[model samples]
Target: MLGSVTTVEGIHYKTKEPVTIHIEHGRIKDIQPIAPDKNNDSLPWIAPGLVDLQINGYYGSDFNTIPIAKGSVENTTRGLWKEGVTSYYPTVITNGDEEIEQALQSIAAACDGDPVSQAGVKGIHLEGPFISPEDGPRGAHDKSYAKAPSWPLFQKWQEAARGRIKIITLSPEWPGTIDFVERCVDQGVTVSIGHTSASAEQIDEAVKAGARMSTHLGNGAHLMLPRHPNYIWEQLSQDGLSACIIADGFHLPESVLKVILRTKGEKTLLVSDAVYLSGMAPGTYDNHIGGRVVLTPEGRLHLAENPGLLAGSAQLLPWGISHLVKNGLAALEEAWDMASVRPSAFMNLPSQNGLTIGAPADLVLFELIEQRMTIVQTYKQGNRVFDLTTSTKE
Candidate 1:
């Protein structure tokens, strides 16, 4: 339907129809259904490239490792292209004040110096130092630095990030949570509740004060809590809060995931929450959060000494999406949207338009063989960036 444009053809990820997408000037120009060809069976599925809201690092690049090596962020950006991530938030977890400021500065510097870093690093996700210091609810974050929120301290880090800190995850159990959440909202920063042991009333107050989301809702919490009115239940009850779940299979079971999907509906979004060891082979490694963690052959990352305790998520969004589909927790289309347009819409990003006449041409082509998703090609702004058939691919 569009004139003289470079077109990409594949089966639509949602409709399952063979179509040709016309691209021009870095956006979608038109999309038209095409008759199935003899080789249609070999064509990959096409959909919007993934948008990850929480990711620490990838491959050997660790964002939490302060004074991050030069080119690390840039390398990670290109590395994720093979996995179909077009936009992502580089997460900075709980740490000493000076260390956290330095980490933000390094990331901001990377974005300022490199075009690739600027393109991929949508914003910074400040995940704590303001979270709960309680044992189980603290998850793997270091407790020594956990403290109450301070607007002045946060302003210092924001200055280091050059105003790129878009999301802050904190616990409402702290005394000044309402005021902090309000200030963050006023600055156009999204406040997400996480790592908490907050009571029902505290959660309600935070939601009323402008906390709009939950960071990996089910993971950062007390392992044991009363069944009646827990923080998890409270977050689930808040229709105003969007739920971000780690569907990596090791985090939440099918039933809970189903409940979240049903409760949140269009508000459900997926986050990788992946630590630095995500793409590494199964092995033991020194982690910043947990003293020593082991990445199992099954891809689960757990504390080495206590095999039963999870250290952090080692799988990314593609694997999480695959797990949901493999377990019948969500349809392929819905699972894909949870990692794509749904998250984009929650963040109010331009990619939320998704597969329409004028959406950004951030697209991916992939296969779903045996319920496992594999990226065949990825395009950002209508330009092919990764292809499976090439040696340059990851």
Candidate 2:
């Protein structure tokens, strides 16, 4: 039982004020304002532990590469908890049907009898197999394995996922994709547009068909494009689309990042898009997508062939928040929302109980040391899942 839990509640979604959050048995019991205590050493700026809707892999473990073993999923969940992510969707990229099926099965089995596994692994994000086949737009995906959206094929994958597939990202302009988007929407699955070369009209149609998000908005496309007309601009201008951006500083330039933050504001969700190389020692490694990637000196993962092209990201949610705050792209509260509440809302989860009564006891404790957000602890369902000080000692 927490004696007196406190959080700094955001006022008007941009400013924070001290508020107490009481928890009992993994759920929020009460929330109330508290006077500042001079004797208390704990900082009051607590927030909900982040929820990542798109995570590929971390700590040298790729869900796509990891064999479907009993402990692999559990180990991955533990790794994610250390990064302050209390919940996330394990993203699976374009791959063979058999491989994808096996991954889903493993994830489902891992969720059994494990709270972190069950809570951390909300669902699966299928990122491809139905996407643009063009070179630049396809990014690191294998061209041979890419295919147009086929309901029959999707049905097979969905069955293998055992109804745990929550989101599917595909190109809206692909043949039969509009129908596919409709079908997914009808089944309560989110359809995101990505790896595309779609026209404005096609994008609009996809939105009408319930396509709601753009995956890694600016990372998968060609570097140069015709002025005043581009798919990036089209997607940016669409009011119905929420964009996920990799804020690892390499996927997009500072200018473009500022433009996106200013334009999208609360509509933008921060995604790591991290690969297996994340949290690993710096060196060259072969991405499963058959390209050579180098973990850079500055700690970013970049495509070895084209320095401009990003292989993936190494940043986590807390790091992204700190970067955004340091760069003046957004206020600390807004950045926190992007990492925590916005993504949850986008995934259709409740944004309430963020230090409020009757909410889940999913919380993060951090301090701003010289304006840097440093995570000190992470709590899931009222259990202390991660503590940086404790982990460091071990």
lDDT of 1: 0.91
Off by over 4 Å in 2: 1-15, 40-44, 66-70, 304-308, 351-353
Instruction: Give one digit per residue, the lDDT tens place, for model 1 in 261-379.
Output: 99999899999998888889999999877789999999999999999989888898999999999999889999999999998998899999899999999899999999989898888
- Estimated TM-score for each candidate: 0.97, 0.92
Q: Model 2: what TM-score? A: 0.92
Q: Candidate 1: which pairs clash?
A: none
Query: Model 1: runs farther than 4 Å from truth?
Result: 1-5, 392-394
* Location of the lowest summed lDDT over 10 successive residues in candidate 1: 1-10
lDDT of 2: 0.79
